[model samples]
Target: MSSTSKPSSSENIVAQKFDRCLADLIVKSGVGFSAGVIASVILFRRRAWPVALGTGFGAGMAYADCDRSFNPARIPGTRIIPASELKKDGSS
Candidate 1:
């Protein structure tokens, strides 16, 4: 039971992260779409490009953020500790 629960706990964390990412994507994309609609009516003269551009920009930002969250080492100047060092240092 203990062994089974350990993997389940890690899976739960992954599920939570995925849920957060999905929520962020929806919210950011919705805001961008609203902004685009406003701009289209006022500035673009009912053009479609602004709407598409805004959606892509929002999605791209969300993707970047999600990638960063999943891969901490991808960020610049992040120190990656080796497994051996972690064991030696006795750090969690």
Candidate 2:
């Protein structure tokens, strides 16, 4: 007999989803940070603070956007809107 309890199928599915979301967040943040760094270097040389600030901001935005899309949660009185929520009838 096994000593450890095996996870159910539903639990496994949830875990897999969580893992996928985490991977997406990491990839998106990395790409965004790299792009920001390159842009900062091209736009402003010798600006260490700007480069760091831009990288952080870009990465944060990328992560938030990915989260919003992947795990959408309806929030009241929030200005931020997901792209998928937009309707063709011109109604929010």
Candidate 3:
């Protein structure tokens, strides 16, 4: 007999579910953080330090939450994708 090991059916199902959940959370958290940053920038321009700081902190927390929400994994560091990657013009 061959000595190969295969993942059980339940393991495959669990992996699929976890992947779907992770994708959804990533999208949601990314959007939320983007909106928060934009709002914070506007507030900063208006000389509202409190509002700006609060919004920035919220964005960081959201990112942390998304990183931890995934199963069978832990993001080693903070997830802060640079805004340049999200630009429409694709100019970095």
Candidate 4:
């Protein structure tokens, strides 16, 4: 007899929530960065140095936002185990 089990309702709900969060983050960050770049280019064409610089900075910040959103390692409260904690046999 096979004993394969289906996922619980709670598990499916949690997975859906995670997927939605990821999708929202990607869309928001991507739109923010694209808008910044576009504004920067427009300001640059108008010879507005301060506005151009501000938009460029915003674009960079948006890029970082996207990176952190998708990569769990970039999340805060995550600890990095020191190399000294490793065993001489190359195992953690």
Candidate 5:
């Protein structure tokens, strides 16, 4: 059997998923942080910290909603199997 035919380890799959999730989170956080900076620096010169915090919270909520909208399995109480596994089962 060739090495390419071997199934990937679960640890590798998990690590990949973790990396993807972290990357998504960082991008989302940056967008939120930028919005916060804009609002604090431009609109509300005083109380910048509070405004930034509030906007950041709003951004986080938006991110959660957006994430759920994109991936239905992200909702609570649901099992999320990767598409590759489904394909392996001939279900796709």
Candidate 6:
């Protein structure tokens, strides 16, 4: 038996997404860490927990965004619609 099927586009590795993901991870985590440092100095008496918490939150957010980019269906309040549903006049 032989099957001729085109490879799925989703399987393709996109360089742009990787670059964006890396940038987001760096920027967001850095921002979170900075914010935590400020908060620690101003309110938390320079404790370490705040910094760690902030970094974790930033990383989690980045992970969510990356996941959504890789699989759009994982995004909240989003759904996948088949091409048939997009037709205006009920024609394929």
Candidate 5 per-residue C-alpha lDDT over 1-92 given as tens digits, one digit per residue, 9 for 90 to 100? 66577677988866776676666667766776777787777877854684558556755776686667557788999997889898999964
Model 6 scores worst on lDDT over the 10 consecutive residues at 5-14
Per-prediction TM-score to the true structure, in the order listed: 0.79, 0.49, 0.39, 0.40, 0.52, 0.73
lDDT of 1 at 79: 94
The local distance difference test score of model 4 is 0.63
Show how many residue pairs clash in every candidate, following the order shown: 0, 0, 0, 0, 0, 0
lDDT tens readout by residue for model 3, 1-92: 56897756987866876676667656665666666567667755644554545555655665566556643257566565568766855764
**Would you list the C-alpha lDDT of every candidate in the order shown?**
0.85, 0.66, 0.61, 0.63, 0.71, 0.85
Better of 1 and 4 by lDDT: 1
Candidate 4 residue-wise lDDT at 12: 81
Evaluate model 6: give its TM-score: 0.73
lDDT at residue 51 of model 6 (Cα atoms): 95
Q: lDDT tens digits, residues 13-88, model 6?
A: 5667878898999988998899889999999999998999888888888888998898899878998888878795
Which runs of model 4 end up more than 4 angstroms from their true locations?
1-8, 44-92
Clashing pairs in 1: none
In model 4, what are the clashing residue pairs, if there are any?
Answer: none
- Runs with alpha carbons beyond 4 Å of true place in candidate 6: 1-13, 83-92
Clashing pairs in 6: none
RMSD of each: 4.7, 10.6, 15.9, 9.5, 7.3, 7.5
Between prediction 3 and prediction 6, the one with superior lDDT is 6
